[model samples]
Target: MKLYPIESGNFKLDGGAMFGVVPKSLWHRTNPADANNMIDIAARCLLIEDGNRLILIDTGMGDKQSDKFLGYYYLWGNDTIDKSLKKYGFHRDDITDVFMTHLHFDHCGGSVQWNKDRTGYEPAFKNALFWSNKDHWLWATQPNNREKASFLKENILPMEESGQLNFVSLPETEILKNSELGFDIFFANGHTDKQMIPIITYKDMKICFMADLLPTAGHLPLPYVMGYDTRPLLTLDEKEAFLNLAANDNFYLFLEHDAHNEIITVQHTEKGVRLKDVYSCSDLF
Candidate 1:
């Protein structure tokens, strides 16, 4: 199986929100903020080339939102899904599955696009079966007040409307033992309800897609959690357990929102799980 890092785009998010209660004096040393106090973030997606299935994990925010809405995030960079796909000699149509980690707009917005007539939305990858777990699907569709802004309807709904939406069925409490794809699935709450983190076996190493579970290497510290998470305390517990497992097994974390660092590994340090080494995804292969 081959894995390609899809560079959808970059955007800025408030550093304070990204690092939760971690003081600016601490987080800023790693994720230095701009003059506006926003830090650079990447909507980096992953493409899996396995057999007849071309699975894409997370579609970055599409260009369908209004300028006003886009302005809030301060979108940056020319990298796009189309350009990224082309770099690998592929096209959006080649994607057979879109495995969404969650339904946040920045993560799944590229799933749908404005139709040619501009009358309504349509599946961005018409032939793809868009995947989301049942719990996350419900959580996003019927979002609570705190998360409503992040779960934009325009980024969702169209997949179901196009008859291409499907769910991965697993016990709410367990990791998916029977993955149809070639990856083991790790379910994480805290960040959001039932966010599926894919543990992919690529080459001789295992790579876990760190979708908000661990946004960047800077987030390796247990106390450094995102403020956006509904259950920050739950996130704390989840991160501790996950990091311990990751450090023991030496799993490479494929970061979704880290702009500079693409992949990272953690070590069991005296201070707790701490960043070990960083690399570009290609460096692994």
Candidate 2:
């Protein structure tokens, strides 16, 4: 199996929002903010090639939103999904499966795009079977007031409309062992309801697609949780358990939202689990 880190684009978000209640004095040391106090963010996606299947995890925020809407996030950078795919000699049509960790716009907006002639929306990956768990699908579609802004209809409904939407059946034990997608599924709820984190096995190494569960290395501390999370206290519990397991197993974390640091590993420290090393996909593969 081969894995590629597909960088869709970069954007800026309020550092306060990204770090939640964590003081700026702490998080700013790692993710330094701009004059406007917006921190650099990456819409980093992952592409996996296992035999006949070409699976993409998370589509990143697409370029369909109006300028006014995008201005809020301060989108930047020239990296795009198509360009990144071309770098690996692949195309969007080559993707057979799209496993969405969640339906937030930054994660799934590129799943759908404006059709030619700009009449209506359509699935961006026409050949891919977009995957989202049943419960998270409902939660995103019928979003609560707090999360409604992040779950945009244009970025989501088109997958179901194209008859390409599917769901991974959660196992009774919660941990899905040897999933057909060639990974173990870890269900995390603190960030959002039933968010699926794929723990992939490649070349004798366990690599985890750390979605919002661990956005950046700055969030390594136990108390650092995103304000956007529905349940912050629950996030603390989830992070503590996951970090312990990650530190113990020596797993490589594939960060999705960290702009500068591509991949990281954690180690048990006197304070808590802390960043051990940082590397990129090319360095490992």
Candidate 3:
């Protein structure tokens, strides 16, 4: 199996929002904010090429949202799914499975795009089966007021409408082994309802797709949960358990929202699990 770090795009978000109640004085040290208090964020999706299947983890924020809507996030960068795919000599059409960690616009927005006629929306990957768990699919589609803004209809409904949407069966335990996508899934709920974190084994190394469960290296601290998370207290528990497991097992965390730090490993520190080493995608993949 071959893996590629797809640079979908980059944007800036309020540092305060990214690092919940954590004081700016603390988080700013690792994720320094600009004059506007906005920090750089990346939509770093992952692509896995295994035998006949080409699976994409997340699609990032697509270019279909209106300028006014996109402006709120302060989207920046030239990276697009097309350009990034081309870098690996592939295209969206080559993707057989688009497994989304969640339905947030920034994560799954690129899965759907405006049709050629501009009349309506359509699945971006014509030949791909968009993947989401039943719980997350229901949560996103019938979003609560707290997360309604993040779950846009245009970015979601088209996949189901196109008849290419599929649901991964939720495991009774925390981790689902040997999923249809050929990886283990770690179910996390603190960030959102049933956000699936993919645990992939490649080249004798366990590479975990750390979605919003651990957005950046700065978020390694258990209490440093995102303000956007609906259940911050629950997030603390999930992070503590997951971080300890990652540290003990020496898992390579593939951070999807960390613009600067691509991959990292954590070790048990006196202060609890902390960043051990940073690695470029080139170093591992």
Quote each prediction's TM-score: 0.98, 0.98, 0.99
RMSD of each: 0.9, 0.9, 0.6
Model 2 lDDT, residue 216, Cα: 91
Full candidate order by lDDT, most accurate first: 3, 2, 1
Q: Identify the runs in model 3 with alpha carbons over 4 angstroms from their true place.
A: none
Query: How high is the lDDT of residue 255 in model 1?
Result: 96
Encode model 2's per-residue lDDT on 38-89: one tens digit a residue: 9999989999999999999999989999999999989888999999999999
Return the lDDT, model 1, position 144: 97
lDDT by residue (153-244, candidate 3, tens digit) is: 99999999999999998999999999999999999999999999999999999999999999999999888999999999999999999999
Q: How high is the CA lDDT of each candidate model?
A: 0.92, 0.92, 0.95
lDDT of 1 by residue, 186-266 (tens): 898899999999999887898899999999888988899999999999999999999999999999999999999999988
Highest lDDT against the true fold, candidate: 3
Residue 49 in candidate 2, Cα distance off native in Å: 0.4
Model 2 residue runs over 4 Å out of place are none
Judged by lDDT against the true structure, how good is candidate 1? 0.92
Global local distance difference test of model 2: 0.92
